[model samples]
Target: MIGARVRQFRTARGLTMSELADRAGVAKSYLSAIERDLQTNPSIQFIEKIANVLDVDINALLKDEAATNSSDETAALDEEWQKLIAEAMESGVSKEEFKDFLEYNKWKLKQK
Candidate 1:
């Protein structure tokens, strides 16, 4: 579950394992295991360490495999983004505007 979540979050952020490992100050191989579920029973502290570096709550990475793991907060964030994008579309915002928005947000995140 955590592996899937890690892979999902990493991919969503457009980061490779090595990139994330560098950001998180962890081993790429270890991160790989975390993504593959081969290391299923990683400790809570281990999970917390990774979560802290990722800027995601540990609970987001600790769901049952059978469940889809978007917490209410994450879902709310997504809904807000969707609404903004939809409003932009209705207002005829150009693709350039969207690209700029995404790039700006990504850059802002990097500043953290």
Candidate 2:
């Protein structure tokens, strides 16, 4: 739930509910209600304020746990691919050279 995610991040950052509410410029009681799931629907403006104070994207707070986990896994894979590309660039692999390699690999797969 959005509330749970919010609480998770807030606690992880060692922020008390009052502190988070104060930083987000929201009412402390309203924030408590949100964290406790007594209030489930918060306005986008409300979410934006909390998200900003938490330093997290609004999507992170809104996504389901499963979707968030998948997104996290995908992000890790993307980071790995980015590092590999950086290594290739550092090794002086030109864009044209990489394009040729891709074309050749495609053709080789077609031949099989």
Task: Give per-residue lDDT, candidate 1, residue 23.
Answer: 81
Worst 10 residues of 2 by lDDT: 78-87
Instruction: Give the per-residue lDDT digits (tens) of candidate 1, residues 1-112.
Output: 7898787666655567888888877789988998898888887877877787655788778875334545767765754664565466657898898899889999999999
Measured with C-alpha atoms, the lDDT of residue 41 in candidate 1 is: 82
Which numbered prediction scores highest in lDDT against the true structure? 2
Per-residue alpha-carbon lDDT of candidate 2 for residues 2-109, written as tens digits (9 for 90 to 100)? 888788767656678989999999999998899899999999999999999877789978886545455777755744664566567658998999999999999999
Q: Local error of candidate 2 at 92, Å?
A: 37
- The TM-score obtained by model 1 is 0.56
TM-score of each: 0.56, 0.59
List candidate 1 stretches off by more than 4 Å: 65-112
